[model samples]
Target: MAALLAARAFLEIRYLAGDARRVSEDRSPEDDLERIRFLADVCHNMPGIAQPRPWRPSRRGAPGSSVQQAMAKRPMGWAWHTAGPEKRAWMLRHIENAGLQWTPPPPLPARRKGPSPMTLRQRAGVLLGRWPVRPPAGHLSLPPEAHVLKALDSDAICALYEEAGRLRLGLGKGGPWLRAHLDADSVHYLVPDPASYYWPGMPSTRGEIDWWQCTALLRMCDGEQVSGMVAVLPETFAALPSTLPRRKQVRLVHHARTTERDTYLWGRDHKAECDPQLCGFVPETTGDPPPDD
Candidate 1:
């Protein structure tokens, strides 16, 4: 039973470590180490981490330290009194293997520094949604060696909107998005930070910087979330000497009409009113009732 429990416990540790790695996120090495230590608690058969069940807990019982009791007698397993080198090495190895930067933690001054002061608090904040809440990927920095357009003689660009209440909802009323079509299937979307998705480069580009700031708008070019929108954002379509070399053939498009595919709803605008008088009664027999057969 001990051996079996030990195997299951290690399996969970590996599973947890793997999960941490698989997520498309960056975490500090200290964070991973803290996780490793808590897992050690599983091997030690400590409280809060009760007897193994499904990885997702849906059962209730007194927490058992059967796994710890089992590991204590196994080869190279933890003993109740030993917080030794073996345990420390085991933790460091897992962190390193997970491809995160691991600095050697400072030597303990004979006092076992269980989990750090911030560890459990950080975990709590994560569960409570107070931490690691990623804000919208707001205007990420452009890639190095960013693409700059000398001119665009054959690209059509404009704004797109879903109809019905698009004007009321003001989909493109802010910093106007500059959409471009490089091909029949390649569509690129661009918008200034404080511009309108509904309006073009008018008051949106009247600000200090337009072209450089709204250069790259990464997005799904294909119908599904697959292709990216990539094109240059030109402020004005003028041909003065200074702006001649910069002027390109850009299509200035206006919103046409809403399509059948625009699945817009006005439920909020047209809600059914409730009457207190009608609440207590079933509907009265309309007009007449048929004679009983």
Candidate 2:
């Protein structure tokens, strides 16, 4: 802006009327005028624009500048962008010497956005079925029966994952529910991962269906609407406190927390530092990484 102002001022002083007929314009005299304007516009205790009072654009139509004369110049732009290179360099140095230190701010970042919690719950609504018995491949189905709970929440549904139980989805219509799953049958397929020091997920040995999918499926049956979120390990590593509370049975309920963001397994990266009994997993051998080109 200072540069723009200085350039505009130069345009007015040189091309427009100032000295009646002819003034070759000696540097020393003209620069003194610029220094005075620079002081008034850019220095401390500036009139009506200092602290507690901001420089308002509506009043001036442009950002405050070192060269006040530029703000008054008839047309904005007015060849300011196309000004001679030598004059531009001179104006830049003039503004720089006048204590102009800031660069124009960069553009703002894009907003963070995604599916809302209700939308997520709706998504979870679609993943449900009888866990032990899947319906025919072509049709979408719910549970064998639906229970109308006075109230249901994440905690209520998460409890089923901790040990065992059954869940069903229903049609508001008439009789039988759409789908169902035997919650205990899920645990038999799970192996406690010592390295994680807690239950990791609803991973299965029998099929590709895993914790991420299971979490969504279970949320659909909960008495309350549940967010369709799943546990995720960050690309970076951090320590996760034991989800398994001391002296209590290991449970998968912690993953159901809405505030839960990243889950970590410290032993995955620092196996030697973690306790063997609590965090040990047999190490798998891997070939050395190939060299970078």
Candidate 3:
């Protein structure tokens, strides 16, 4: 894993250097940054590469160059060169002309009502059943709308991945659930490292998935808004006390109650009770540890 990661990074640096040399003949510094950013996004988003922050497309340059002129058009060679063939193909799906263009997938076929919790084996079978193991570079494709329906007929497999992340949060570390592999039945397969430990707004290397990040990803894929209720890993990885006592829990419950009440009163114009037991949140009146522990 480490070797593959190093090689990918080395390839990126080489590609950036080569691109800089090639484009320098006609482009300026600002153009170089834009190109680099595009390539970075492609590489960083790939499953194997680990980095914080995805590629950020920007047009600005150091103090004296062109400030805001629209960038010169170029083929997505930067993306193709840095990203693996699988990613290169995915990026191509979004390309319009030589640039990336967001094309919302056509409306999916209406979902079929179905059973739940298909195992890793089942999903691998379905994915393989639908497409060849590998397609030619830049030629790979998603199944047609009807076919996607048949393949992911139930959202359960993905849901299991999400649940795995959540369980990790309470456990405070990786365990069997976090290690659940994704692939056809009975044997091993690859799964992307959980995104929980990642810093928000940044790309992160592959590692055990974080529950909060899993929650967000699941919501994004399902096209739903994320809630603030999801908890983040503490900024510092300092060891915390194993568990708080009942008094602390009670205090937290009270604080949550008050906070919830005030929030509802001011925002929703409703007088709502803050139930420590029901909501698991303490009112502000009590200074307590976070309920997440």
Error of 1 at 266 (Å): 35
Ranking by TM-score: 3, 2, 1
Which one wins on lDDT?
A: 3
Candidate 2 residue spans exceeding 4 A from truth: 1-141, 144-212, 216-272, 275-280, 284-293
Give the range of the ten consecutive residues with the poorest summed lDDT in model 1.
Answer: 251-260
Candidate 3 residue 93 C-alpha distance from true site, Å: 12
For each candidate, what TM-score against the reference? 0.16, 0.17, 0.21
Evaluated against the true structure, the overall lDDT of model 2 is 0.27
TM-score of 3: 0.21
Task: Supply the global lDDT for candidate 3.
Answer: 0.30
Q: Count the backbone clashes (under 3 Å) in each candidate.
A: 9, 11, 25
| lDDT of each residue in 74-178, candidate 3, tens digit only | 122233354666555545543443454543233222212211244454345444452212222333222221111111111333334344446444322212211
TM-score of candidate 2 relative to the true fold: 0.17
Show the lowest summed lDDT stretch of 10 residues, model 2: 169-178
Whole-model lDDT values for every prediction: 0.29, 0.27, 0.30
